[model samples]
Target: MSLNTIDIVVFIAYVLGLIGVAIYVSREKAGHEKDANDYFLAGNSLPWWAVGASLIAANISAEQIIGMSGSGFKIGLAIASYEWMAAITLMIIGKYCLPIFLEKKIYTMPQFLEQRFDSRVRVTMAVFWLGVYVLVNLTAILWLGALAINTITGVDLMAGMIFLGLFSVAYSLYGGLKAVAFTDIIQVVLLIFGGLFLSYTALDLIGQGNGIVAGFAALTDQAPEKFDMILAKDHPHYIDLPGLSVLVGGMWIMNLSYWGFNQYIIQRTLAAKSLEEGQKGIAFAAFLKLLMPVIVVLPGIAAVILLPELERADQAYPQLMNLMPVGLKGLVFAALVAAIVSSLASMTNSIATIFTMDLYKSDAKPRSEQHYVTVGRIVSFSALVIAMLVAKPLLGQFDQAFQYIQEFTGFFTPGIVVLFISGMFWKKTTANAGLAAAIGSFVLSIVFKYAWPTLPFMDRVGIVFLSCLAIAVVVSLFENKVQDNAVDLDGVSFKTTAGFNVSTVAVIAILIAFYSAWW
Candidate 1:
């Protein structure tokens, strides 16, 4: 792949524009004190639109753009269950989980655990999350983004990683969550527009310059086998996405843990101005979720039809970009960059928030608000450096980086979800039970991975979640039932505005229609 002068100019302009936005947003406003809330939570002032766009921007990274498209090339439309299921998951979390989290006034997910269980559980989980973010999530995003850039522009992979890190840190470290969230609005637009353009072009090329509908028809007619939303037991990739199980089984565990409990994904919702706004924003994000497969997944399906001889599935995305005209290639490249940098900023901000609020503030004595904010910036910068250093080498270990990410993260999700769900609604859940379940879930994950290697990862996750939930229940039965000290939700109204209700209904209706048509 090569870039012309027009492409180079567009790419440079995009980078400069992002830098300008970051500096502008991070500038100190008069009378607005720089404190923990202001820095970490955006002063709890993010309105519905920013929250919704930032949530989508933060969630869709190179993982989706590069990795998921790879999966689409390899496994077809079934892979999109991750995105489609997440729409329902977000609605469920917004309806049931957000009220409790907001009422507790908690800054981090681990902090909520501390309130519901004990300090030991909080610290243990916090450390676990920090490791996953730095070692797995952040590293994966950087590595994949660097791979894409290197493939398209011929830049060295390490140089690409460093450049991305500096660009993300430039604004995020100073402006904090506010800057990250607000700038995400633009990032989301670029990502959507560029992604759509790429998909359209890929389809048009496949369809011999016909419209998208004809291109899509050609795709299905040429590779009819690729359109299945559910897979058969004997299908080559069935282990990854088994039929019926995807609809009713372990996929739910994955979706719930990610959408409801993940720190980076939910942090924007936590920063919303009010519960009503947050719920509405989440509903809007659910609507956007419906369109992701069109942008991210369709191009890969088209790739399978157009570039069938490519050796690697991961090359599907960059190979498609190679076909775009010079100016459009630059625009699409900027979109991919936007996806990578926005996610990097969001993760950096989140890691900083969790460490500063959950660990440092509690472990050390309380200091001035400004002091904590300073520490957050330092943590953000350090985490980025560590991730950049490890990303390339760590990602080299896997043949398919996307599947590797899902399976590795699967090790922790079952336990975390079991802990949160049981602790939230079940008043009898004891701290001892929470601690035991957490430790037991990790052990079970290892046992399943090594001892029963043939078992599907999704099935393993489902089994672990149930086993841990049972253990918690059995242990609680033996111990004295703890009094309910969960966050009081009496003051937080579950009543959503009419717009939110209608939008949510529309999202659900669309999801049902999609599955019905595709399945």
Candidate 2:
């Protein structure tokens, strides 16, 4: 819980190194200032590795690292279905979805909606995302991250939040997504290695001086109940996991909305050097997905054996950090901070991208690309400031801010998935139908929540998604009019390279083996 000189040195070094890299990677060429594309989309020139690393860095944060570890402590590996299922979801999106987005040369998800539906749909979704990202996503990341740091190091909560906000801005504000995407490579490396090492330390504690393999055996032996990949109907946490629904139902809806349609997460893929490069990057992310539970989940499971009666499950990771030896404690702490700020930077960048590109550019007078890029930087800073200011007011009262935020977001995920999926694939899908799906998804979700209170959340999501699809279909059928804005896939290729194909097989095979062994 205490950081000695060694830990302080390591942490400071990480901060300086990350900032230097961000500045170096985002430097302007002589006589050429950064344009909108360069700032927002990283000049559309990211290699497969940077794109892949940034996506994972953007997705995994304090919420996943700390909250999921808590879930591991409480619910065992069942909590990891979200991570594991996302692996396949990434592959599916890479194969079928990224092509559509990349081919359109869009800057944000809302832009794609404008192309296929209308400006109204685009504006509506843009406003919705901006609200959620600022009030919910950004706030939760900041609050939870600060809380994690405070727990481990006794730092004041407000100071921790301020440091995170400033650090995120320091490395990312000036350079925009280019800074975020490139610096994220360092963040991802630290988080992955630090997380895996922490898991090893915790497992080794359980092994009582035995090696990692023996530690693994001890975990399965001592806390066998936690290892179940699928929960039973009577399991206390079944409501959260919902047995098979995770595999066949609403979990897919959740993953698609996040991995395929969400702005911040998809922005990485959108920045790829080419369609093929992006798809390859996505495949790489899928492989990384398979390893997340080890980095994020295993430590909490180890806690069941290490500190079995902790007051709260959420304390699993922070308290477990007490076990990290002094020399490496700073390194692991840097890893934790890496995920936090990388996610913070990614969210702020996306918020600015959506506001500046989708809303600001549309309404503001035409100007040079530098003008918009400047606006983006200002917006990014403003969003971070607002989030830091309001984070406590918004999230302070919640015991499980992470879960509450997730549940609140789920109210609309089905509708979003339906609107995008129908608009993209159904040629006759009308604008009115898009509105119907988008709006109906939320209203029906509320009705279902109160009327069928006991329905598993995953099941509710799947049911609402199907209902939205049906409503969209009925509305479109009622109009029975020809449409011209359906997605044009003739120009996009679905073929995968030999490397991608082989990687896909390897990822799936690994997932299958993992679940089967733990099942």
Candidate 3:
């Protein structure tokens, strides 16, 4: 696609502005000697609003916006279960999960495991997280970002991949989490605006033939099959086993692991000024989650209704951009770029944190702040290059990049979730049990993913999590619980009960809404 003059101009100007944000943030971090906490956790000084915005931006990347909408086009609204299911997951984390981490003042999820179990468990979990962090999450994100940029700019995928990889790496390495958060606020705003504009234009196109409500009504009536949540065995439009399983079993595992234990998303919470801020920031993110269907998913349905015969699902989102007027196209294009960059910065910074804290200095006494920060930058750049290499192969397999990432997530997350949740409040969970649970669940999930192709994905995840929990519990009962001389739970408490109240409402509301919407 040849971008006109206005599109070219808007794209360049937006890239420049983000580069400027990166430069300013890098200077801020450079001014101080960044301690371990300062570099990894943003010095624990972020305000509630910035944390909230960063959380949303970090979580909603080009993959979710662009790739998820592509899923919507293929699978209809059932694809939206991922977003809605996350509301409940966030509430759980904000209540049961966040306070424990906050009170402990831990830098990474693995650090919590170490305190709750043993250093061996911590190190093992760290290796698991690092592998997923680099190979699955970061790689898929970079690939899709490059895909979106390539679609808009007429550049080759490799070239687009390299450009974005370098640009995000430069700032993320220099400034640490502080830079990521500040720039994320800007990225979120642009992404929302861009989505709104694209949705409006798509609606307008539908309006040209029929009024807004009528257009949607007409589309809905014409292909009721598209809106059906259940798949028939024979029909392409049917929500087959893969589709249904993803909704039922797959989403829960992904959301819980991601919100509860993943370092990147949870890092925003760690940066909050207080536990209250963190809880509130999470609530804000939940509210935003409700809007995702409007911004990303609904347009995809509309695209399918309008352009049903398109050869590929990945083409749906970019094709929607083409429907906009020239100037509006430029603006929407810029917004997509912002979403890509925001996600890149978050991942790059988080990868650096994991490497520096968990692996590089795992046993060493705390190093000087400057030394850690300098090392963080180098790690970020290295990760970016790795992601670029992975992008090409990933994009080739899945019609939409989002599903490709989710499929791989099944391999690691279920076990990690089982290990962390059990380890956190379950005192009887010994370090050996924690390790066994994680490794065992991972093995079970891999078995389901590859060995048993006939089984549904969600069934596999449920089985893996259950198997791990059972093993961990049984092993802990038989073996002596590894007692850490320094193990203490008091360090991780959030004295106020604000999260409980909010979480109660969120859980009930999500349950009612989820069942009611489909029922």
Q: Rate the local accuracy (lDDT) of all candidates.
A: 0.88, 0.89, 0.75
Question: Candidate 3's residue-wise lDDT over 1-519, tens digit each?
Answer: 767898778877887887788668646434556677767787898887788899889888778887888888887776776777787778778877888888788888877777777678777877877777787777777777776767666678888778777767655666778878888888888888989878766765766656567766665766565565444456453322245554566567778998889898999999899988888888777777777776887788888766788777876787788777787788888788777777888988888887787778734577767887788888888887887787667566778677667766766677788788777767777777778887887678777767887665656776787788899889888896555533355666545465657655866687567656553
> How far does residue 513 in candidate 1 sit from its true spot (Å)?
1.5
Question: 408-444, model 2: which lDDT tens digit per residue?
Answer: 8889999999998898888889989988988998898
Which segments of model 2 are wrong by more than 4 Å? none
Which candidate would rank higher by lDDT, 1 or 2? 2
**lDDT, model 3, position 17:** 84
TM-score of each: 0.97, 0.98, 0.92
Sliding window of 10 residues with minimal summed lDDT for model 2: 398-407
- For candidate 3, which ten residues in a row score worst on lDDT? 237-246
Put down candidate 1 lDDT per residue, 402-454, tens digits, no spaces. Answer: 88899988888888888899888787888888888888888999999899988
* Model 1, position 380: C-alpha lDDT score: 94
lDDT for 47 in candidate 1 is 97
Candidate 1 lowest-lDDT run of ten: 482-491
TM-score for model 3?
A: 0.92
Better of 1 and 3 by TM-score: 1
Candidate 3 overall lDDT versus native: 0.75
* Pairs in clash, predicted candidate 3: 34-369, 103-491, 103-492, 104-492, 231-238, 231-239
Q: Model 2 clash pairs?
A: none
